[model samples]
Target: MIQKLQKKLEGKLPGIESWKRMAVKSGKGESIESESLQKYSDWISKDKLNDMRKAAVLIGLFKKNDEWCFSLIRRPMNEKNHPGQIALPGGAREKNENLMNTALREAFEEVGIKPEDVQIIGQLTPIPVPVSEYLIYPFVGVIDYEPEWVINEDEVEELFILRMSELISSDNGYTETWDLRGNKVEVPIFKVMNETVWGATAAVLSELIDIAK
Candidate 1:
């Protein structure tokens, strides 16, 4: 089944235009189950969104022991925003680079995966992150071999290897309540490697899974 799914994914991925349409139709916060629904409600306001900082993340895929997998990083607790959160390999965009370059550069810096090794496939919806005041662009890519990750200990607390089969399984999704901004709210997340993945990271993955369908 995994091999079959992999073949299907390799056939034809949606292009940039499809990504744009998907971004608008992604249902924003309402699509992905999260505690911070209010912030995403205003995601469609182009004027306000344009004022926010820009960032990018890479959803990289590779094969391991005949199974498709991806990588996620746990941010160090001392970071200013989204401390100790589970995230894709990415960061804020630099002044001289495009979104794809930002994603590739950040992934290399954080995980030590060489930029040349990654084949840029496409991208998912661009989502606005209110807490960080940045509009994050999510790009999808694939590598032919497993990476020998050299994690930057200062920025990354730990590395997570998540399998595509687990992500697409019905049992992986769950709802849990957490105290956020003085309010106890219910957040939908994917349970992977005994960790809770929520917020923007989960939102992007949720859209990617939808696109795969």
Candidate 2:
């Protein structure tokens, strides 16, 4: 099953080259061969990570009827952060909230996903987005039945119910170009239906696809 998923989700979750290396060292502990440990080590290698903060996101996976689907949203055009970009249900870590709670809170705030409806399967290693100063802990969860979703317009421009089957499709999973720094850089991007899922969302998806598909 893992092999089938890995094959099916190949380019679907791109740019996990580093993560693939981490998984090769599965020593079975909190600090096994995983992105969490690697990112922490990478963080130490850099001098700026100490000034960073924590964040959390719910990698909420569910089924619409019998078809598997995941929630996505385009941020409002007016937001100061990663605005107008496609992303998962998550946000900044508040002063007193844990990562799990932050995921739950952000889900509700961004969309209308009820906290109790999600059954958390487990957590993925925290991925550090150094440029954003956010160390994102991506938690994977499942909802038994797809709930009718609504978008909070103040934060979400559009609420998308993307079928996982389509996402895992061989051709749709590919990379694209980005104008970063002073050069035209290429980044791993996922194309599903009419939307493009990339950046941090794609990065987290890369780990999840590597782990469980």
Candidate 3:
């Protein structure tokens, strides 16, 4: 499974490469066909938003054995904002955190994934949702010997170990076509098992799917 991901997900990709590529499109008034990602290399490279909202890193840990394969998760429904949805182990970013650090911290807090156990090999592009006014970063991390995960019952309902082969072949996600204030918007979401992961999570997952597939 790890080898499979390494092929599907880049072992390494540059932050600035994305920005340079995006600049080309901006100059010609061409729409960005890129999935969900920022043209800017870093937070400082982009135009400063009136609201500088921060977000967390959603990490997917895939494990497989003789007959089982799954990714880690925390219940999104019943949570304050993104309630009862299926999602990766991540949350809001803390002050003075690098994007990678924020992801590691959130994963640890949400699923008891130790920072040392998970090795981050690469990251997906930045996903910013205008409605939420936050930029979300997604990373690909690997953990050997799945640790004993204890969900923070206060914030999470349970830990879902989702199968990968099934995810790849079965219903991996969803998409919604709607209009926001008369502007047509098509939002895509992922159906991981019974959980529906949408918004920034779905966008980030889309990128991972392209690179990893």
Candidate 4:
């Protein structure tokens, strides 16, 4: 399965056009996105586009108990952004650093993934996160074996090993009403373990899932 996904990803990615339709288009003709991720239409407004910073995340895949799996982390609740949310290991790009290095570096800092241990296979669509003013690039990588994680307490609250097959097979998506800032809004999410994943992280994962299919 991993090899198949890697091969498909290498040739061509289902890019931003598909992602925009999936993320923002309201099947009901109601404006679900304008209330939430309206930036899917333009990534960022023209004026703020130039000011957006770059970030990257890793979808680190490995085999465990003869099954393919991937790693995810939950941020500490005290975090200023996306606190308590499950996410791919990643952070902002540093000065003079490339986005792929940002993904690998942040993965190492947050979860002890050695850069040499991962074979980067391909990348998914880059998504713009308006709330955080970030253009997030997501990379897919494979490691030969499951890792004994060394977690950074400052960045990670918990770690999860999710079965890649289960994610491919299960009904992982659902919607719920959330109070964002002050407005009551409906949000789409992926139910992973006991956690709810939404926003930019979910958007990235959604694209990954589509590619895996």
Pick the TM-score winner.
4
lDDT of each prediction vs. the true structure?
0.74, 0.68, 0.58, 0.78
Candidate order, TM-score descending = 4, 1, 2, 3
Q: Tens-digit lDDT track for model 1 on 1-213?
A: 334434544555442223221221121333322323434445444356567789999988889988878899999999998999999999999997898999999999999878899987777767777678788998888889999999999888999889887887833447666666665555667788889887778777776776665
TM-score per prediction, in order, is 0.80, 0.75, 0.68, 0.86
| TM-score: the better of candidates 3 and 4 | 4
Per-residue lDDT of 169 in model 3? 54
Task: Return the number of clashes found in candidate 4.
Answer: 0
* Candidate 3: stretches off by over 4 Å: 1-51, 66-78, 171-187
Q: Positional deviation of 82 in candidate 4, in angstroms? A: 0.9
Scanning candidate 3 in windows of ten residues, the lowest lDDT window is 18-27
lDDT digits (tens) for residues 1-213 of candidate 3: 566766555655443343322221222334333433442323455665324576767455645464334345656466666666556677677777777888888877877778888777666765565546677677777776666776777667767776655555533334455553564554444566676565545555555555544
| RMSD (CA, Å), each prediction | 5.8, 8.3, 6.3, 3.2
Clashes of each: 0, 0, 14, 0
Worst 10 residues of 2 by lDDT: 22-31
Please give the lDDT score for candidate 4: 0.78
Model 2 C-alpha lDDT per residue in residues 24-86, reported as the tens digit of each score = 222222312255545667666696554679888886777676776778888888887687888
Q: How many steric overlaps does candidate 3 have?
A: 14
Q: How much does candidate 4 score in TM-score?
A: 0.86
Using lDDT as the measure, which candidate wins?
4
